[model samples]
Target: MSSPIQRVRTCRDRGSPMMTGRTPRMVAVLGVLACAGCVDRRFIIESNVPNAQVYIDDQPVGAAPSHSSFEYYGNYTVTLVQPGYETLTKRVHVRAPWYAYPPFDFAAEVLWPFHIKDTRRYYFELHEATKTRTDDLLNSAEALRLRGQTLPAPERPALPKVKPGAAPIQPVAPDAQPFPQPGSGGILPPPRQDNPLPDVVPRVGP
Candidate 1:
């Protein structure tokens, strides 16, 4: 039977050194380290306005001149807000590096000699706020309303009415008698008893 030392020598002679227990562990560790270099990259964000607040996907990152890391290679929404300045939004696209894509990615993850890092920078200019024209718009609307009020209303024609049952009467007479006036003296007064009773008494005595 071969001893332990003799067995080790036989393994080397057969060119199977990787079959050793410790060598497999070492290779696994080295593979893990090599693949770690292909991790996502860091992106730098900056703006002309100093100390502006920054947000990514509605999550606050930091003020301007900030640093952020992403694990994706797609579109991202970035927002910048500052006092007395208009808020701004940006759509950032993080494309994978040429080496980190397709068949070449295999070389970058395993065959590349050094750790590869992808760093990107973005810059933006913030604009100042402007005066609002809401009052001017309201004034223009009021002027239009007053001009409408000054215009004459359109006249509508009167509609004729029809009764259910009505006779065709004669025409009115032109020479109809008129009512008497109060100050024209046309009304006479009743007679008084001044001489009527005296004449009746004389006839009775005869």
Candidate 2:
């Protein structure tokens, strides 16, 4: 009979192949359980003017030379405002990388076991706000006034042309009678004259 220690060693050697076969499966299961994919995306905004306020999609983010994280890729409206500088507005399109698209994204975002970082940077320059001088403004006003004066006045509608030999219109006096007298082609009858009654005799009463 073989020694018990030697028998145990032989059995372990015979089973080593089975252990080896299961090792890869165990590793794969552990990887699926513990590993995950991630994507980190951010953008940096900078301006020629330091400390300029930054606005993204009309919402204020912070001062320029700053950064913020984003989740999706597309057009972004960027605006920068600063004292004594003209406000800067622009549209920025962030294009996705190959790994961020469709089927590739699935692998990069779910199956890949490492974090992927995507970074974008933007820069803008601001122009100084132009100041208007009082003298120049006054000059412009004066020039406009002169030009207006030179323009011909709109001609009054020409009075209706009077035909030749047409009767001239006579102005009526304020106190003139508006109606004609009787027998002067007027419709009203002549006024009636009043007759006086003979003096009544007081002694006639019986």
Whole-model lDDT per candidate: 0.81, 0.87
Pairing residues by index, what is the TM-score of model 1? 0.52
lDDT of 2 by residue, 88-193 (tens): 8999999999998889988887778778889999999999988768878999999999999999989788866778999877778654345677678877444543
TM-score for every candidate vs. truth?
Answer: 0.52, 0.51
**Tens digit of lDDT per residue, candidate 1, span 4-48?**
999999878777655676797988888876876554578788999
Model 2 poorest ten-residue lDDT run: 188-197
lDDT value, residue 153 of candidate 2? 81
Listed per model in order, the count of residue pairs whose N, CA or C atoms clash below 3 Å is 0, 0
The superposed Cα distance between candidate 1 and the true structure at residue 8, in angstroms, equals 14
Worst 10 residues of 1 by lDDT: 197-206
Candidate 1, number of clashes: 0
